[model samples]
Structure formats: C-alpha cells, structure tokens
Target: MKKKWLALLLGTSLALTACGSNDDDNAGKEPAENKETTTAGAGDAAKIYENKCSSCHAVNLEGGVGPNLTEVGSRLSKDEIEHVILNGQGGMPKELIVGDEASKVADWLSEHK
Candidate 1:
C-alpha cells in the first residue's frame, strides 16, 4: 500500500540522518597523535603559550598584565625563563606552567627572542 511504502521511506531517511550526525562529535576531536603533538615536543610550545600565557602576555606576547614576552630570550636565558615559569615572579604566580611544559615554553620564548 502507499501508506506502507511512505512509512518505510521515512524511517530509512530518519535512520540515515541519525547515523550521519553521529560523526559530528568526533569531527571536533583530533587523532591521539595529533593531540599529543599539539601539547608536547618542540613544535607545540606556541600552542601551549596560546592556551596559558596568551591571556596575560597577549597573543603575540606583546605584553599585557605580564611583561612583553616578545624577544624575551634576548632579556633572559633559557634557564632563567624556565626558572621564572616554575617559580613565578612579581605579580605572576608560581607554576603558571609546570614540568616539561615549562621547559618547552621557556625554550620557545628564548628561541623567538
């Protein structure tokens, strides 16, 4: 009957639409390796800065509540930068960044300077 055929067609269309939507959640997620790459290693230091330091230091590190981090390497050595990130200085709190992340950001700032 026409009613039966229309009902089947509508059901099939709904199922297909639901299946297509299921991928939307995963579309926003990077693969595991890419996620790790964004948070780890030499290349990811800028991403870490954007996540943590950009708020205070400004997107380009031109300074904000914190001092301009642009060319910070020229002002501080890598070890000094790492020490500050771990210990904090002045208005900044200690451990704004910690562990290997501290070292990576320090390395990045120093290199940019």
Candidate 2:
C-alpha cells in the first residue's frame, strides 16, 4: 500500500510538472533574422505558436489538452484572443507570451476564419 501511494504521488508530481508553464525555452536565444513587413506575418506567428502553444493546442490548431482553435477567429475577435493569452482562460495559464508577441499571435489567430 505504501509503495502504491508513493507511485501515485510521483506520477501526479510528474504530470503537474509537465503541464506547468515553461517560459525558459527561448530565454537566451536571439530573435529570428526574418522580419515581415506586416504587423504579424503567418510565418512568424506560426513559429511562435509552435514554440509556445503547440504542446497543448497542437500544431494544426486541433484540440489536444486545449480546445480546437481552427475556427477560433469566427468565435472570438483578436482582442478577445489577446485577452485570453494575456490573462488565461479556464485551464490555460496566463502570460504564456506577453507583450507584442502576444498581439502578433492574436492577429494571426484572428485570421484563421
């Protein structure tokens, strides 16, 4: 019984750690060289999504741990998306990608519909 409890505790801890936000992925990395003339190009935004959101949201915007975002634009405006990104909603943690980057991502997502 004690061993079973210990195993359960260990598993829960690992699961929580995996789900927790990880903000250090790009801590020391330099900005990308490619800069689009537009406010937020598809390429740049997609890259950001891949780096910061793909784990839960999926690379194709299909549902994973998070809801499907394929038609998110039809459901929510850029401002709403930005608000969610900044403040988090439901199970999502806040400030995953703050500042201009968040805005850029919201803009890109707003075009999905």
Candidate 3:
C-alpha cells in the first residue's frame, strides 16, 4: 500500500511538471514567422491570456491552480494587475508576458469587473 501511494504521488508530480513546462523554446530570440506583429488589442489580449495563462487561470477565468479572475478588475486596478503580470505573485511566475502584450492583457482583464 505504501509503495502504491508513493508511486501515485510520483506520477502525479511528473504529470503536473510536464503540463507546466514552458512552451517558449526560443526565449529572448527572434519572434517566429507565425507570431503576430500588429499592435496588441483586446482580442489579442484574450489570445495571449489563453495561450499563456489558461493553463493555470482557466480559459473562462474560473480559476484552477491560479486565483479566480472573473472579477479581478473590481479587486485590483489596471495598474495593479499589470504589476502582478510583470512581477508575478505568490505561486505565479513573473514576466509570463511583457511590454505591450502584458499591458493589453492587463487592460482586458481589468474590464472583467
């Protein structure tokens, strides 16, 4: 029984780690051809959130590993949200998105209230 429990724990850990692995293989390198070059907007912000945040924050902002952000705007101002996005907080890693992309996402999320 103890061996079975240990194995299960290890398996779960491995699975979570794999799921959380960064997909950005070319960090700090030139953007890929498929990458969007236009100015970030509301729609782009949603896409960014989906690709970079949904794994933990949930696609619907319903929360999962990260806190629920359905009404984050009511809780935090746009500046505060942007700060968190740039600096991270608690279990979240910093700079998941930056620059205009981060600003746009923060603006989009700030409207959730």
Candidate 4:
C-alpha cells in the first residue's frame, strides 16, 4: 500500500537525520583542560607571573607594553583577572591557558598587586 511505503520512507529519513545530528556534539573539539596556562617552576603564582606576566607587565607598575600590573588585585576581582588572562583584553592575545595552571597564575597575579 502507498501508506505503508510512505511511512517506511519517513521513518528511514528521520533515523538518518538523527544519526547525522549526533556528530554535531563532537565536531573535532578539544577540551578546555588541555589548553595550557602559565607555568613557572617551584609551584606558585609568583613564580608563574615572574616567568609569564613579567614579559609584558611590570609587577611594580613601572609599565611595559601591557599595563602596569601593580594593584591589579584591588582593581579587578579574581574572576576578572582570570578572564583577562584566559580570554585576554585590549591588545592582549589569547594565549592557551586552562585548569590549575590558569588558577595558579591568577592567584599569583592577585598577590603581586
């Protein structure tokens, strides 16, 4: 019957559409944890900043290509600092940073201010 054939064709089409959509969730994605954040030896933010942030921003507010990082803690909250470091701001580039490495650098920046 025409009705039976139409129903079977519709069911097959729906199954195919659903199967294709399942791939959308995994489109060559990378995990956020895999992104590298700042890292310096000796296991602390100060060390991380010394190695990573010091290249651009001066800890004492002497100024550099980036803004003087002094008082950064007072000016920006921890979340703000983390966002800036992770996502970047103004002319800053978005460097690869994530997970504990990101937290360590944020803590170090918070203390340096």
Give the lowest summed-lDDT range of ten residues in model 1.
Answer: 33-42
Which stretches in model 1 have alpha-carbon errors above 4 Å? Answer: 1-43
Computed on alpha carbons, the lDDT of every model, listed in order, comes to 0.83, 0.86, 0.87, 0.70
Clashes of each: 0, 0, 0, 3
Clashing pairs in 4: 36-96, 36-97, 37-97
Native-to-model Cα distance after best TM-score fit, residue 2 in candidate 1, in Å: 43
Candidate whose lDDT is highest: 3
lDDT of 4 by residue, 1-113 (tens): 99999999999999988877575686896663453532453467666666567667765545599998777787887778889888988888765355666677777667755
Worst 10 residues of 2 by lDDT: 34-43
- Model 3, residue pairs in steric clash: none
lDDT of 3 by residue, 1-113 (tens): 99999999999999999899585886776655444433333548888898889899999999999999999999999999999999999999998887888888999999999
Off by over 4 Å in 4: 1-39, 59-61
- lDDT, residue 83, model 2: 100
My TM-score estimates for the predictions, one after another, are 0.62, 0.63, 0.65, 0.57
**Which candidate leads the pack in TM-score?**
3
TM-score attained by model 4: 0.57
Ranking by TM-score: 3, 2, 1, 4
TM-score for candidate 3, please give it: 0.65
lDDT (C-alpha) at residue 76 in model 2:
96
Instruction: Return the clash pairs for model 1, or none.
Output: none
